[model samples]
Target: MNSNKAVFDSLRNNLKVHYDGKRFSYKSKHDLKDKSQLLVLIRKFPEGIAVIDLKDAYPNVMDDLQALKAVGQIWLLSNFDSQEDIAYPNDPRMVIKVDDDLKQLFPRD
Candidate 1:
């Protein structure tokens, strides 16, 4: 498990400034098949992280699913804000009509 520890350390080191403004910590372990050599689990501190059961954004993420673990977990690091301000389900296609709000942000300039 030393290699796993290294991965965890690397992840934490990289997240030092990415998960700011939160107050939690998460640790996960997973085994991978032939596709991926490693499958690490993600989680948020405490009970703030939401659990996404279905495969939406990343299907490969499910390879490390565990019944006792929480899915769609967020973190409370020092760089990431408690919440994100990005919009979702927005289209960038000008041919397809989009809401005025998204149109302004996703103009075809």
Candidate 2:
């Protein structure tokens, strides 16, 4: 199912950088459809990667969900972290969570 190949192509062709003056650019080797793909993303952009509505992106993918928690990259979808089962209840990084409302990050979604 090529749900949205154009989006995927864009992501693959032009890797976005955080531009923290680090000049770091990332290449996404895989799509964010499953845990394995998420792991590839982690391996590619572990330091500064953001995912919005992570559940919508990788629904029912346990490995992807766990990787999000393990890597601490998916910030906007804080609902996942607040769950009682998660290790972190009150995340100290609540300050940055506000960016989730920006919506411009993943405009095509």
Candidate 3:
């Protein structure tokens, strides 16, 4: 399995977390206040699909992606378009679809 595949598999088997109206209600009782992204996702996904977005360096994204995979949830990382040329500002990271693979989750319509 490639990186994405390995991550997805980890997510599928490891994390048993779900969201419900401003409540994380995870299977584990451990607190995750230190994990900023996790906290954000928990608070923001009160009534929507759970997803984590990453910005900044690629290595950081790789690590967080792995972590999120361990938790068995879907996530997205975005990149900024070239600042020098303003032809297009790349695409924003938004939820398009949910699938077992990355290819199917894009081009959100």
Candidate 4:
């Protein structure tokens, strides 16, 4: 019984360490699998797509845009505001487009 308890504790500790390591190493910005569809849509328009259109198509448009922007995978442009200004994703004037370097990753059909 004591030996079994010891083995269980050792396994638990090992798993905890492994989980912690993986959790820290994972970067949400770099993980775009869930946002692939959004990327493809953005890639379709070279000049950029309207944020309102994206919002209409994607329920989580803001989160997806911010995640892509965080990783330099996409750019959010607003004709009325400077880059430093906060642009609302729901605004019709805002545009979302894939980064030029990453354009190849999301090829248009």
Winning model by lDDT:
4
C-alpha lDDT of all candidate models, in order:
0.33, 0.45, 0.40, 0.55
lDDT of 3 by residue, 43-94 (tens): 4543432222222222354455456545545333333442221111112254
True-structure RMSD, every candidate:
16.2, 18.6, 19.9, 16.4
Ranking by TM-score: 4, 2, 3, 1
TM-score per candidate: 0.18, 0.28, 0.22, 0.42
lDDT of 1: 0.33
Off by over 4 Å in 3: 1-34, 42-53, 57-59, 75-109
Residues 1-109 of candidate 1 have per-residue lDDT tens digits of: 2348676556556533233334224323222242122222232123232223222324464443332223222222222453422211112232354689987886485
Instruction: Tell me the deviation in Å of residue 90 in model 4.
Output: 21
Off by over 4 Å in 4: 1-34, 81-109
Clashing pairs in 3: 11-72, 96-108
Comparison by TM-score, 3 against 4, better one: 4
In terms of lDDT, which candidate is stronger, 1 or 2?
A: 2
lDDT of 3: 0.40
> Residue 3's C-alpha lDDT in candidate 2?
60
- Taking the tens digit of each residue's C-alpha lDDT, what string does model 4 give over 1-105? 235868645544552232342232222222234477777666656666666545534356678888977766677777665333222323223558668889978
**Model 4 global lDDT (CA atoms, 0 to 1):** 0.55
